[model samples]
Target: MAEENGAAQPQVKMQVLAQFIRDLSFENNVALKGLTGTEMQPEVQVGVNLDAKARSQPNTFEVNAKFKVTSVNKVNGDTLFLCELDYGGIFLIEGVPQEQLHPFLLIECPRLMFPYIRRIISDVTHDGGFPPLNIDNVDFLALYRQEIARRQAAAQAVAN
Candidate 1:
């Protein structure tokens, strides 16, 4: 809360009301047999997606960060394990201008939620009898820019 020019303003409030694992799935496809104890190191494939949507309440939104990791024995191409996680947070944002809303929601909000989600991924894998997979830092600004360009291209194509 702030006061300026004899008026009260929303003070650019941003808060995370709650965060949780919306969905999670992990598969250890094969027993710990040939998956390990071999000369070849298993390759891990990771996929990531981020999404945000407005909630019914004003200034509230849902932000989702999704991750998928698959492990494969390189030599045999055999599946070792797979894990998919959808993590989300409920956020409250106020007093931001409309022009800044998209980036704020997509980039900033998810930026705040990523660490907790990453830890969940690591813990799930470690408990499943594999090494904890520490995720790398993400560039949210670049991601947001790409998404904006993609949406604009789609709109331009539709306009034509």
Candidate 2:
């Protein structure tokens, strides 16, 4: 049976739908080092955080996928560059399968967001005078698993 509303209501079916970084950017501040030949064995630290938000309008959602990249020289511990990207997208999802939603939200969404994030990071690094740092392809499934494991471990520890 269809609702009285003119808009056709889709049958609730399970399907995976995802959106990812259509773009990405990186800003390397160590551009001068390449030209100056300043040798620095830097330690790199990378972190990522994923978040979701509901839009004011109906059936609209926003996902924020963030990556933090920091480089520091091990010798003197001088910070070389700190890059943070808040990449996100707004999507409309309805009638998607429950089984597929996790992949859609975790994997697909990040993939769509990646390109924009990559561009941003590259531009920032180039403008900062460092060689462009192109991020490698991310395995969202693996990342999601790791995140879940970490969270579960933390929760368990807290409970204990």
Instruction: Estimate the lDDT of model 2.
Output: 0.70
Q: What is the lDDT for 31 in model 1? A: 60
Task: Show model 2 residue runs off by greater than 4 Å.
Answer: 1-38, 99-103
Quick one: RMSD of model 1?
A: 3.4
Provide TM-scores for the models: 0.82, 0.70
Model-by-model lDDT, in order? 0.86, 0.70
Candidate 1 structure lDDT: 0.86
Q: Which stretches of candidate 1 lie over 4 Å from their true place?
A: 1-10, 32-39, 156-160
lDDT of 2 by residue, 1-160 (tens): 3566666666643222354553454444565344246668877777778776657865566778888888787877767888877777777766765566655677767777777777777777767766677777778788889988999999999999
* Candidate 1 lDDT tens digits, 1-160: 3465677754688999999999999987666454446555589888778888999998899999888989888987888889999999999999988888878988998889889978998999899888898878778898888888998999999999
Candidate 2, residue 67: lDDT: 89
